[model samples]
Structures are given as C-alpha cells and as structure tokens.
Target: MALHFTDVEAALDHLLARLPAGLRVAAPLGLGKPHRLLNALYARVEADPSRPLHLYTALSLDPPSPGKGLQARFLGPFLARHFGEDFPRLAYVQAMKRDALPAHIEVEEFYLQSGALLDSAQTQRRYASLNYTHVAAALAARQVHLITQKVAREPGGDRLSFSCNTDLTADTVDAHLARGLPRPLLVAEIDPQLPWLGGSAVAPDGFFDVVIDPPGPHPSLFGLPRQPVGDADYAIGLYASTLVRDGGTLQIGIGALADALCHALVLRHTDNARYRQVLAALDPDLESHPAVRDSGGLGPFEVGLYGCSEMINEGFKRLVETGVIRRKVVDDAALMRRLADGTANLGDHARLERDGEYLHGAFYLGSPDFYAWLRDLPEVQCRAIGMRRIGEVNQLYGGDEGLERLQRRDARFFNSCMMATALGAAVSDALEDGRVVSGVGGQYNFVAMAHALPDARSVLMLRSTREAHGRSESNVRWNYGHATIPRHLRDLYVDEYGIADLRHASDEDCVVAMAGIADARWQAGLLDAAKAARKLRGDFAAPPRWQHNTPQRLGQSLAPFRRDGTLPDYPLGSDFTAVEQRLVRALAWLQASTATTSGKLRIAWQALTATPGRDDEALRRMDLHAGAGAGTWFQARLLGLALARTARDH
Candidate 1:
C-alpha cells in the first residue's frame, strides 16, 4: 500500500520534525508540482507561533508565476502568523532580467492576482495528464527526503555509506548538531532521474525520525493559450518531424521547437497515414499492447519511442491522450499497480497509475485544466516519465540483455540544439569553459543511443534566426564558437530554412547543405566566409537560388495551417497575459531607473503596440533598444510572432 498522510500538511509536519535545526532542502525548480507540496509545508510552518523558520527557494524572478500572488498573501501570512518576527523568507532569483523584482515572501499588492493554477475539475484532468497528482507521497519517500550526493569517503570513521556534506545552502554546520538524527535512519527516497549535482548530501542508513515513502512525484503539465503558429515555427517543425522515422524512442525538450515538431508529426500521421502501414501489418498480439499500438508505423522502428524527460508537461500529455504515447512494458504486476496508484520507487517508477507503470517528477506548473488532470491520474491513463533516468542511454538502464531486446527496435532520438553549423557541427550545450549551461541532461545520452541503434538518428532543430530589436537575424551563423556536438557526431539538422543531412556529408557538403537552409539574407555571408576560409571543398558551393528570405517560399513550404495552435519552443505555455502585459508595461514605464529599465519598458511597449497590428510588419520594423540580458525580448517576440501569423492566416 502507498504511504498515506492525512493531508499535505501532515506530510510537511512529518518532514519538518525530522530535519535537524540547520538542515536545508534543495528541491527541483520550475513548472513541476514540487512547489505545491513545498508551499504547503511553508504555509504550515508559517502558521506555527513558537518556531521561527527560515525558508529559501531557488527560482528565477523574471518569469513570475501567477501563483506568486497566492504564495505572498496566503503563505506569507501563515509564516508571519506562526513564526512572527522569527520567520525569515528569502527567494533566490536570478538577476538576469533588468526589471526583476526584489525577492520577498510578503505581499506588496493586496489585490494581486494569485499565481495558483485555477482549481477545477478540468485542471485536475490536465494535471493528471502530466502526472502531478502524487506530489504529496513522493516527498515522503526515504531517498527523496534525504539530500544525498556522491562524496569521497572521509578517510576515517565508519565508512559512511552516506554523509551530510553540507546544508541545503551548503553552509557548514556544527557536526554534532548536524549529527542530530539517530541511526537506522529514515531516508526520503528520491527519483534518480532528477538532475544530480555535487553537495547537499543527506545522511546514509541511520538518522531517522520516521521513514515515509510515497510514489515518485510527477512532472508539471501546462497548456498553451490559444495562439497562432508562425510560418517560421511551422517550417521548422516540418523539417524537424521528418527526422523521426517510424519506430524510434523520442525525447523533446521545452519550447516552440518541441511543440512545432510534435504538432507537425501529428499532422503527418493524419495527412500521410499510410506511411506507417508497415506497423499495421504486424501481429495483433504485439499491436494490442498500448505502447506498441501507439507507435503507428510512420517510420521504421528501432526501440520504438519511450518518452523520457524531466518535464511531464501538456505536450506529452497531448501525445498520451492522442494515443501517440504508449505504455512501457514492466515485468512486475505489483510495480505496475503501484505506479498506477501514485506510489512506486523513487529511482524506479513515478506516482502510481499502477505500480510499475507510475509517472513521477519533482514539480509542476500549468493551467487549471492541466492541474485538474494531475489530481486524478488513473491507472491505464497516466504515465510518469521520471527525471532520474533523464540522461541515461537505453543501454545503461536495460543493459546488454535489454539492448538485445531493443536492438531490433530503432529509436530515433529527437532533441533540440542551440546551434547547428554550416559544417554540421551541432551545439546543444555551452561551448565556453565546458561549464554546462544546462547539465548534459539526457542530450548526450540520447544522442549516444541514437548512434548505437542502426535505425536511430538524432534530429537537431535549429531556428534560422531569432527576431531581435524588431529585426530578424541569423541564428544559423555567428562568429567563432565551440559546438556541443562536434562535426563527427552530427546527424540531422533542421531549420526554418530547411533540413540538412549531416551524418556522412563532407565538410563542404555539410556547409552547403546547412547553408542551403540558412536565412536567405545570411546565405551569402556564410558562403563568403566558407569560401574565404578555404572551408569549401569539392564541388560544394552556395547556389544562386538561395538568395532571399521571401514570404512566398515560406508560405509554400509551411502552407499556412491553423493560426491558433501550439508551436514547439513555447511548447507547454507562456504566462504572459494581456492584462499582465499591460501591467508589466505600466510597471516598466513608471520605473525610470536606467537603460535596463527602459529596455523592459520597451518589451511591453512593443508587445502591446504590436498586438494591435496585423502582419506585425509595423512591429517587426520597429527597432528595439534592449540592453544585454537573457530572455529580454521573449514576451515581445512571441507576441509579435503570434500577431504576424494570426494576421496572415485570417
């Protein structure tokens, strides 16, 4: 039976009591449901009068959640009510956005809209879709509760299987006081798929107040607001989708590229249904399996596609509902049952839909529809894709025996890349300092898997250019930079410009192929550079036909589908609302701090102004002067793209 707590509060109380006075909690960040239970614990602690508590959360403030409103008013009071002056709340927000607000737990606006996803039945279903229903139980797990890490053995003393490396904040604490818990300890079992990093270690075997294990937590499910799909997005999607050959395991990351790719694939399944007929002719016994039935033989099968990701957001949920997502095979019935019921292994299954087939994640963020679904994930309906095995290649988990079973199955690995070179060098991660911007987080693993499977190939999606300062520029070409995936490992590269088959292409051929799809305006520049640097070889050279980024060509290629549909990059959704946009603009205008302040003001200004015009041609022509910062123009660019597409479609 799954470990049960009376309610969220009971679970938190259980955890709080076990924690040593100075211990810290490092939990998953972002649109996952981990925050829900976390907030509940904070609220409970906030209500307590005698115990002064210090709470800190790692979140980037620029992407403010609608949930923040509820947190400030409801949670802030609970903390103040319980701990009085003793409560100290700190939020660690990245200082990237110029207009980012200072972190505080208190409510500044009495009428600020609460950031909580609306509570409703539909929300429950959507949440269930992404597998966020069992967050409460997952936190109760032994491995999860304890923050464990791989630490070098301390040269002496009792060969510690696990040792408290440091507090959650990595502060040194009195070892005696730190050794607060007794032996035969309670460990909060965690999902192994979670991003592993050094530090924040938990105690090993002993040191338990009580050991509680709920199934692995589920991922967040978010729904995109009805928005228009741009030609650029559709084009990219079409190119990316072509890489998935009927039967390969798939992994799609967040963003428009992910949405576009998935959406386009869905379209292919409908428009070119017979392309997958080979799978239809297979035996009914194999076909009867949910996992097998879902493959729908659009391409050849390697291992078939098993969706393994850190996020269980709405896009994945859509795949499941549409029968595009299939069930995974497990040997044990009890495990499957637990997985279905929202209870299973932290390292194994996520929340139980049934034991072995559980869905799991650390947290969630989404619309009420998504939230509702999460609350009631039923067996046979939901599957949690945990983060623990996030980066592991299929071979590592299943081993040679499992590989043999999967050998016949070709898994096409679909992942996003930040940049794809003219020479077919694909960079998915940071090239500078080898300091990973995002952990190798499954990209390398999946890529390796793609190489291992004969039928498998990695599809790397590249946007030709991103709109900046109200102007389009090539994302395909830039000055010297390192590649995340070097030329040797290059496979398939996709862009709004087109698709480039890079695997066996010569360097010159690769450049010609990649440049063929680059923004028309940049093709000459790329070609000039390639020829000048002696990079061009053989008969490969830029052709004259690739001379312009004309709307006519893009139109013909993408064929203006429904405007109001999901795209890939902003796949799950964006929180920017019309009202919120206005407020942000107002906030930006009122704050006259510096170039940074004006830059933020510009984003809202352009978005609001641009939304009114069709074709967004006016907005596109409007120059924006934003100072250096990350994701500075996301809101404006997205709005402009949506507007342009909407106008064109209508």
Candidate 2:
C-alpha cells in the first residue's frame, strides 16, 4: 500500500483519469528530461493515433547556419520529435543578452502604434510590447497544459491541467500538504535533491501515493566568457559607488563591469577606511559577521549587502560564504523566526539587511552546488522581483529621498550600453536593415528611474578601445549608426583607462573627457581626429605617459595581483575548462604586448616549440589569417617570412 516505484504508474493513471479528456501538457522549455508521468502521456498519445494531443512548447531549434545557437537540447526527444516538424509549436530561449525578449517575436504592431496618438490605457491594452508577454499569451490561447520545474507559488487559477509536486522529504511533504492543492496531481515520493544537504526541502512529501526514485536528469549548464574591465568600467564603478549610500541596498547584474564596481568599492574602503568605518558603525549589527573582516580587506565600512537578482550565481554565494553579505540587523525577529521555520517565502530567506535597507538579488546563474546552499536559507524578506517592479521602484524612490534615506538608501544603478556616442546615443548591439539586434528591455526604465531618484545616478560602463586589424583601437572614435541611450542622458562612463563624467557637458567637453580615459595608445589619434573635425577647441596634444593607458597596461598592472591571489578576478564557478584557461591566459599575454623585438620573438618561438597544442596552433593561424592582407598583421607576418628566408640563405 506504501508509495513505491510500482505505485508511480498507478498514481499517474489516477491523476490522468481525473483530468479532462484530450488535455495537452507543456513543460517549461528548459526543464530537463521528461518524468515518467510525461513519458506515460507520450505513450498514450502515440497509442491513440486518432486523438493525438499536441504539446505546445516554447523550445526552438538553432538556426541552420553556423552562427545560430543550439536548440531542443534541454527538453527530451519526446517533445522534440513532436515539435521538430510541427508548425506553430515553439520553444523559447535567450538569443541575446541585450534584449530580454526572444528574437522571433514580431514587434511590428508595437512599433507602428508608437507612432499613433493613443491614450495610455489604450496603448497598454493593444500592445504586447515584449517577447515574454507574447509567450504568456501564446500558452493562454492554446489552452495548453503547462508544467514547470520551479513554479512561482501561485500562477493564477485553473490554467494547469496536471502538476507533479515531486518532493519526498518529510518537511517538504508537510509544506506541500499545507498549501492544499485542488488540481489534478501526480506525486513522486522520491527525493528530487537527495545528493545535496538536509536543509534543501521539497514541497508536499506525503501527498503522493506513488514514489518514483528514478535517476534525475542532468541540469542545464551555461557558459560565461571572462571579460576584462576597461577604462569606461572604472568610471562607471566610481560614479555608481557614489550612488551607493554607506549602507544602502544593491541589485547588480553580472559581467566584468559588475565585478569592477565591486572592486572599486574595495578600493574605496582601502583609500578611506575611517570614513567607511563610521558608516558601518551606524548599522545595527556592526561587528558580528566575518565578511567585514575576511572579504578582500574591507574596512569599517564593511557595508552589509543583500542580493536581489533573478539569477543567483557563485559570486553572490561567495560573498555570503566569505562573509561580505552575512551581516544582518534583523528589524523583525518574528519574521526571521518564520524564515527559520521554512514556512515563509523562499525570496525573503535570501534577503540580508545591511545598514538599514534589505539586500536581495533576483538575478543569478550558478552550479547546482551553489544553488543548494541558497535552497537551505530561510525566506526572511526576500521576494522574486520582475522588471515591472524594478521599473516601478526605481522610478519611485531613486534620488528623491534624503541622504540618510539615500545612504541607507538603495540609490545606485549600474548598467551597460553597447555603443555610446559623443552625440548621446547608446545601442546594446549592432542594428541591421529593418531589423533590431536587441530590443529595449529595462534600460529605458532604469534610466528613467535614475533620473527620477533624488540621490540615484545612472552609471554607464564602456571600454576605451577594442581590438581590430590584430591591434587595439579606440571604441570611442568608432563610427556607429545605432544609439540606445543618447549623449545628453550619459552621466558617468568608465573604462580601464579612467572615468569621465558627461552629464550636461558640451560635445567637445564630452569628447575630451572621454578621450582622457581612452587607452593611451589611441588617445593621440582620438585627439587628432577630434581636432581635424574641429571637435576640440584647445589642446591637440596628449602626453606620452597618458597615451600608454591601454588595456594592456591595465592588465599588466592587475596581473601580479591576480597571480598572488590579492585580486580575485576569476569568474565565480568557472565555466572555463583546463584547456580554455590556458588559452585565456595566453591570449591575454599576446594581446598585452605588440613588441616584435628580438627578445619577444624569441619568447614566442620558444612557446610555439614547447607547447604545440591546439591553442598555439589557433594563435599562429589567427596571426596568419589576420595578416592575409595589407595591415599590421601582414607587416609582422611578412617580416617573419623574410627573416625565415634569410635564415635559409645563411
């Protein structure tokens, strides 16, 4: 009578009997392998050829071309087979980071309506402005049965045909029972997160009459490329830090710039420890947590931080484990006690208070191990926040609050733009004819919010230069036709070279200020171009010392710190394999020095001789490929060819 493996089939059958006939079920696009219940449904669909229940999915295949990414890998072949050839059934995934929306959604109606004069209510009613909204509507119209790996506690009513609450632990089961599920349910008594710790509880442990302890599928994995912080990043970090009141809340996105902003805070504490200390003492629990003492030499200003991001990654956990985010001054002990009991929401448990504001992050990405730790934490005051709320709060409380409210205030916002011109336009990605590479997600919202906040500031991080023709060139001077945030809105721009404050500045001042932070190698060229175009009113010359402020120099300066473990620049929970790590380091070295001096050439030759792996081959081949025409690479390759010929002659 006990729920066991045999009970699973029976339990599923019973649930199926209760469901309305001909109901179709769809799972989250990326949710791993089909459960036995889903497998059973597929078998039923195949056996009953007449009433084939169609499963509408958000999954899609990568484009046939090389540039197109992978598709249908997350879901099992069962769903893929049905949707692969079937029109209208689709799967959705992130095609690009600049826009939160999928690439396929046609925004023509939204764009066309922007031109028309319509009331706000009418506009809201008519426009499906974002891709996700379309996804929701699609599912709703199909009347499709949807299942999710992690369902938001309440996703409205009667939409789901079947839900498998698959947690088997005692506590998890108890939690599930309390929720009082009225829908058709197929419960699996087997533990879903068994290999992990005890704190990770599941929902509704005893409600399932059938238990299936079958091996769980592998979780989806993602990769993140390591990028260096540049001049523009430094500027943004500094300005954004200014927005961070001594003990305010923070919600940061991931990337090199995010890392840079954190590093700048470390640097700020180092530069002025006393000021930071005074700030920290104001917090309720000033001297308790280890993060204040252990994390990267943070001083008295060891500002307690809580995360509020959608994607919780290793960086956030590391901050907690290492103690940068553990210092909490609980305002409501009863609420904390509720979280400890695991009865409250998961979001609240993750919220950490510092100074006065609660710190919570809604965005993050990490390995299963990292998430397991988060899974155990009590939901104190944390909540899963969305873009709509993000836009709303930022617009409401940004800078209007007093300094006390501001410092304990969550006023700073850090974001990135793809291209920012001297003329005040920003673009997240390149635009092509009649098509947008990226859609406006929350940039406009955040910018507007920053402007609305009394103490808030919008800091834009960018690099001074980019690599081209086997050499680095100033990105500031590159000709761009796209714009996302315009020049007039530009506040603080940071690169590895330096920071530039551009708000309300003349175009010339903006260009000069921006040029000052350009890689020293390209500073003169930028200045000369500005002069030629009459963009600069005064000095046409830049000092040689300033000209050397390239990414290469910044990396060189930062390298020793990394080697000694003084600076933790490595990506948290690395996606870099061993071979990739070597390639990354070698590539960084190669980019750092352009010297074709005899000593440098000797070193390069030795490296090629000693390690003739794919990495070396790729490096050599890249040089040859880039040198195919008349450019710097061509000159370097030609010289090498000449030197080889002379050696043969000798």
Q: Evaluated with TM-score, which candidate comes out highest? A: 1
Using Cα atoms with residue i matched to residue i, what is each candidate's TM-score against the true structure?
0.55, 0.54
Q: What lDDT is reached at residue 447 by model 1?
A: 66
lDDT, candidate 2, 444-498, per-residue tens: 5456555665545566666666655555556665346666665667776655555
Task: Give the per-residue lDDT of model 1 (tens digit) for 558-592.
Answer: 34233333232234343444333333333333232
Number of clashes found in candidate 2: 62
- Relative to the true structure, candidate 2 reaches a TM of 0.54
Stretches > 4 Å off in candidate 2: 1-149, 152-243, 263-311, 321-357, 378-410, 432-439, 528-535, 538-545, 569-580, 587-650
lDDT of 1 at 172: 12
- Return the lDDT, model 2, position 210: 38
lDDT of 2: 0.42
